[model samples]
Target chain A: MGGLTVMQALAAKLPGERFLYLGDTARLPYGTKSADTVRRYALQAAHALTDHGVKLVVIACNTASVGLPYLQEALAPMPVIGVIEPGAAAALAVAPNGPIGVIATEGTVKGGAYVRAIHAHSTAPVVQQACPLFVPMAEEGLTDGPIAEAVAHRYLDPLMARLPKPKVLVLGCTHYPALKGVITRVVGPEVTLVDSAAITANAVERLLDEKGLRATEKPGEHHFYCTDAPDRFARVGEIFFGNPIDPGAVEQVDLQ
Target chain B: MGGLTVMQALAAKLPGERFLYLGDTARLPYGTKSADTVRRYALQAAHALTDHGVKLVVIACNTASVGLPYLQEALAPMPVIGVIEPGAAAALAVAPNGPIGVIATEGTVKGGAYVRAIHAHSTAPVVQQACPLFVPMAEEGLTDGPIAEAVAHRYLDPLMARLPKPKVLVLGCTHYPALKGVITRVVGPEVTLVDSAAITANAVERLLDEKGLRATEKPGEHHFYCTDAPDRFARVGEIFFGNPIDPGAVEQVDLQ
Candidate 1:
């Protein structure tokens, strides 16, 4: 899910920076696994990305973010930034005085990455809620309608009632933004919702610029790789990127 | 999480089935991955299960149920059933007219397996809510307490207000029964909450009996395998199974 959106944003923002988006289609969705399991899969993905000549790696998935410490250790030499810190930093910056709500996958919420990161920089309390179903819906392109609205209410109602009602809500997982509309409505118009992808993309842009790793040369060729059916990846990637990605651009890579 | 439940349930009901529970610890959360990705991981897990000489296979995860058609085709010749059909069947039988609420991972909700299954058998209204965070909480042993209660209230309150209220609430995911107490309290006592494992076990027992596949000798033994760290699996499994599961019994499987 993060694979699709991050690539879309990158294409729009850094038109000249070559991007390689790999979906571990064979073993996608690391959010439900244990921390150890997430770390292993993340390392494998990082290795593949690095081998593809990615100067900087973005751990777009929140589950992967929780294991960024392990990924950083393995993917050292290349600068690696996870979606959590950038997001946490952004949430804090936006609502320094109010509570911040973080919605993510079960694994990410349990790891307490956002909570810790948010708490580290500011005294603003962090309220973490894991909306596990959001990923599947986003992936399935079921982000709108009564079903989506019902789900948004089911997840956001309780979080909205908490003391002071969080002014800033963090879309912790990469797949979450797809459900942002329904989520925003459920949480109400007053609360500010944060999508990590946007923040993370901005952070990536800054990191690349500061480190002199920004690709300034070509028209930025984009490559999409999945561990499973390449065609399916392209189909789903197209939905995520909000544009038709050429099937030819998507190919399969053996994660095993 | 299902690993521990399988082990405990096996220890009690069918000890003769020598246990080998693979955690897929490496690729733990099959729920968030795409249908194609889930099918591939589930197939890998089934291979491990068949390799262990198990006559029957249970795709314990709810997400797998949405993709059961694919799994049924892949694990052919061997009788394999996912938690969805049995669970949906159970809910339908109890509440032919009453509304049904389903809680599951994001993937399961997106698949609409429960809704389709229920609609196919009965006219009962189905309200499927995705409690994406529940899996991680249960795995983290945050099954009870202020934090868990708060989380459950946040997720269930909206579902509670949905309609005339559901008579039966299906705990669509295997990890959900752990949160039953809080879920029941939040949703209210009027609704009967369903646990997929119990329903699946009942279904499994019936199938085994009908086919004369029940272990007629000693009790069945369960072996748990995860693709991640054994210690982490065992620790989380122990919390959910309500017993001290020997960490040594959990062997890590390599997805690569």
Candidate 2:
């Protein structure tokens, strides 16, 4: 579900671009693993995608983006893009000066990637809040309503209590966008919610144009690959995409 | 933390027994995966455990135990023990008849292993509740608090509302023991909570004794292996084990 926003970006910004998505279903929630481990898995997956000969590699997952350097190095000469930088940019644009908030999974928050990214942007007070439950709730398709609201309130209250509370909150984890309504309600009217996927997609489009690698004018075709359980992947993909997915092009791959 | 209960049992009940525990830190939270994929991963892990020359394979994870038949079949001649049957037996002992509840990960409950096991004991009405968020909370060591209580109340409410509600509730997942206090408070009086790990360990003891495979009177040394991220595993193990652990003993093995 963390890739939903990225997928949406694929549709909106680069409608004619072909995408090859590989979901490491066997080793999901990479947000819970150590830095080195995340890098290794991300490299493995990037290699799998490269086997298909992709032109650009997008780390659609915020968790996997924790290992952006490894992914980039593993796929050298090919362009590598990650969600963190785009989200950090959006936060900087919105807050500009001080007091911005970041919400992500425990690993992503603990990895300090977004915090580091934002700090590199400006000295804006960045509060990293890990809403561990949001990922499961989003996967359950419990995106909106009282349950999401309650959970959001609990996680955001501490971040909100600071003097001159955050005016811009980055949906640091892609999954956070799924719970946007509830999260927006919890954070109240003052904060601008930055959508990382949209910003990252814009970046991708810019990269393609700059590299002069834009595809010929034709509708794009995309394929999906999962390390394990294509059926479960489809079920989850349907929830994230908010529609019934076509399973025809989906394949279950064993990443060595 | 899936094997925390089993490890606890190993230390207290079979102090003389040698154990080799494997936590598949890579493909974790097997609760959300398809049955076939779980079987594949569990088999790979079992093969790794067998390489240590251990006499037994205990599927310490309740969620992984859903694939026990696969593990037992793959590793025949060497015995394989799972937690579901033991937990069901404990539930039967507490309630004796109808109206029992079972709380586990979505995979374990949805697998219907507990229902099948409990049905063999008695034709009890088993309510299988998947408090998926509880595992993450427990891993974070947020066992008892307003957040835990609120989550517990939300998840336990429907089970509590059942007419002449379940008199006995089985803590189906090993991780459930960490949330025992909050769960107990939510389920309230008149309901008995059955711990699956304790019961499973007792079953393991009986099996070894019957097979004449019981170790001689000497405290035996043990080892721990993880498919990935041994450092993260050690950190989480400390939280579950409630003490600092020796990271030197934790080996990260790639079970290909």
Candidate 3:
């Protein structure tokens, strides 16, 4: 999913902040990368966002958030928030007693970011499944149909096979939020799906409010920039943002 | 998949030709954008490939290949080959008499690349469905499980429900080749599956040999680059090209 969608969702949830999103569409899905590499990319992205004069930079990409320390260090003065911590906190808040499940890309799952965050707060046995395909499925807009269901099952069966299934599941990647319906069905009515994006959005709102840096009046200008083609980002940005977003304003930027 | 994977695969099929692949993993999966946008991205990618000093540039992404004329115009002087034409040719060769089904990202299906290519050579009716999620699934390495199957069915049901069961199905995207098993099951035993990568590999071999541009002796360096984090591409590259693959060679590139 693109950053615009996350920003849009965050804007709707908080309603007081001016957001400028730069989706690294040219170089997307940091999910498969190493922590060091993700950190570097996140740092670059953070610099871009801060340069746009955003009050606070939100590391919307879960991969980047999982490796947030580097990003935090990279953006020394600007406040940055990631989805992992907030989502972990939210999951721990409501699910103190249940088995917590986390599904994300192989890299995110391998990073043990959610597991670490969850373990810090609760004693629930965290079950993790690398639902790598969920991102592409969501990006392709395969939310609820038969194909989506099949893909969901393909990734879910192994996790479900383990005894004492997880009662609380973390949709670790931002892209996975789009697959909530199919994921919910596959896990059955027993599981509580926690979307990290929603939690992250809430965290952004809270951070902005606490810092007293909310953008109040004007409908802020959103200049979409991607390392890749702006045109491609615009088309897919609509799907990612959960709306029909136009790419007319997007300007392609080189992130060297 | 990396050009390294393509080179390795084609090395056996084509024999003794030097292969250079520019995956554009930094700006991957050109399947969700508009025709013009895809063409532009393809041109940029082609220029990168051309700059590598290769005799030909393969628009490996099916989505970009569908916008061939525009790409052709954009990357003039350099002989360009797209996956769509070769894949279509292979599908027709196998099922000249029966209906052919194509599953790809929205852009590919919408562009009618496969349909147009196949129709040019054979009388067989072509059935197309936009399986946009398949790429993410494959990239994430979730091809074997219930999730993969579910996603496949989600895309297939609508297409299968309407069209006659195809004797051949084209795996238009490089990522889709990894999903051959899941797709085969969904499409059934009767349908033949054609992978665009395989066709492109063979085509590249043929073209290089015909032009005396095949590498002479030593294996060429397969330097991978991405606009995003190279580590993610490297990890996924392991799934595609096998483990023990070196990501140290994945350089960070700016594609603006």
Candidate 4:
């Protein structure tokens, strides 16, 4: 539901930093497609972001993180960070022991990036589920109703029923954090919800500080761009960011 | 559910003709997107199809029909058919007068192609409703269940309650034919459901025959191509086509 998860994280954590956010609404929800297509779309989106001459970029989307290397290569010397690593690290820290359950978009789950990343940190049996409908449900703003609960139960029931019960449920898709209440209720009180947005925000802060690329501007202004459907971005942007984005500030650009 | 609606219609109608079908499984369901994005994608898809040396191109999708002129211009002298004209023609034929109901994707409905086409034929009030979830529902194979009925009732109830009730309800999206049973029940026996697939197939037949492009050969071969994720196409493709498609036979092509 909240497509601007990482952007919100960085914007909130780094008040002095200016951002040129680009949403590839044209080929969005890249969570369900093949690896090759996601990689291609990610590169195109990264190119659009860098075209604005921003000093730093964040692949706020977990699915698009697969093409981080390509983006870094293309925009060398300019810093770029992806959400997956930060998310995995956060999940491991949250649950030092026991099984970890990860719910993400179809592509991220199918890509097994989270599973592999989690394995590197801990020996817990990481269960990954692709809740494709969660994105649509989140976009519709049905965060805690019967429909959202039913959908949550549909995806979380099996993960909770594993032999080694998962103590930490990583909300891999950014939109998922909106359904946190419903997800938490379904998974019960014993499970901790790890949001990638907060984790990535912390990572962005650390990376910027360590690299000596910190900015000192106060109340930084942000501009938004989209590959297609700027109107949709302006309309739905409020759901992601609590504040309404000015329609005039959100412009459409050709990513091709 | 009937992803191959138009193609299935053509396959059934013209058994002796060779067909090469390309499903843009990567960036699909163009019904909710902006006109510019849809036009660009349609052009890319059409160009991919023509690369295979096909004699004619058919835009079975109502949403992509807007890009027909662009496709025609790009591949001049090659025959092309869009589902909109055929669907509108079929509806007018079934209901020579009065209000005509059209249900399709958001892009197709908002594009107002049906309204213009219907007005060109009859002075009847054209009622167009955008059923954005129908495509997802159809793809999920929830065609005739309670969920499908509920969705159908939700969309068709308003159209059915019109002053001059719609006599013929055009199933604008290709995938909509699968939901016909539910739509028919909701609209009652008084209303006729016009399927774009059948109409477009007949139009294709007429166009081919008039141009003397009919083949006398027996057992025509069919080829399938996808821009990305052939596995998804082959899986959901079974609902569209009554038979299962061999994944090996389905080739992946780069549209870019």
Error of 4 at A68 (Å): 3.1
Docking quality class, candidate 1: incorrect
Superposed Cα deviation of residue B239, candidate 4 (Å)? 2.5
Please give the C-alpha DockQ score of model 4.
0.46
Q: What is the interface RMSD of each candidate, in Å?
A: 6.3, 2.0, 4.1, 2.2
Chain B alone vs. reference chain B, TM-score for every model: 0.92, 0.96, 0.89, 0.96
Which stretch of 10 consecutive residues in model 1 chain A shows the poorest summed lDDT? Answer: A1-10
Who is ahead in TM-score, 1 or 4?
4
Query: What tens digits encode model 1's per-residue C-alpha lDDT throughout B94-161?
Result: 88886888888777888788888888888888887777667766765667766667668767888888
Measured against the true structure, the TM-scores of the candidates, in listed sequence, are 0.67, 0.94, 0.77, 0.92
**lDDT for each residue of candidate 2 in A6-63, tens digit (9 for 90 to 100):** 8777666887778888888877888787777788888888899899888999999888
Ranking according to lDDT, highest score first: 2, 4, 1, 3
lDDT (10s digit) by residue, model 1, range A46-103: 8888887878888778788877888778777779888888888888888987688888
Report every candidate's CA lDDT.
0.76, 0.83, 0.72, 0.82
Model 2 chain A: lowest-lDDT 10 consecutive positions: A214-223
Which tens-of-lDDT digit does each residue in A1-256 have in candidate 3? 5455467778678665555778776556777666765676777777887777666778787777865777677677678788889878877876786577788877688899988888887778888888766676566565787766766777788888777877778888888777778888998988788887677787887787888877677466556677766766777777767666567777777665
In candidate 4, which residue ranges exceed 4 Å CA deviation?
A69-77, A142-144, A163-165, A218-220, B1-3, B144-146, B184-190, B218-220
Number of the top TM-score candidate: 2
- What's the distance in Å from true for residue B90, model 2? 2.0
Q: Please list all clashing residue pairs in model 4, or write none if there are none.
A: A1-A138, A31-A107, B31-B107
lDDT of 3 by residue, B131-176 (tens): 7666665665667776667667767877666556687888876677
Per-residue alpha-carbon lDDT of candidate 4 for residues A52-137, written as tens digits (9 for 90 to 100): 77777888888888778887897798888988888888878878665889999888988888888878878867888888777766
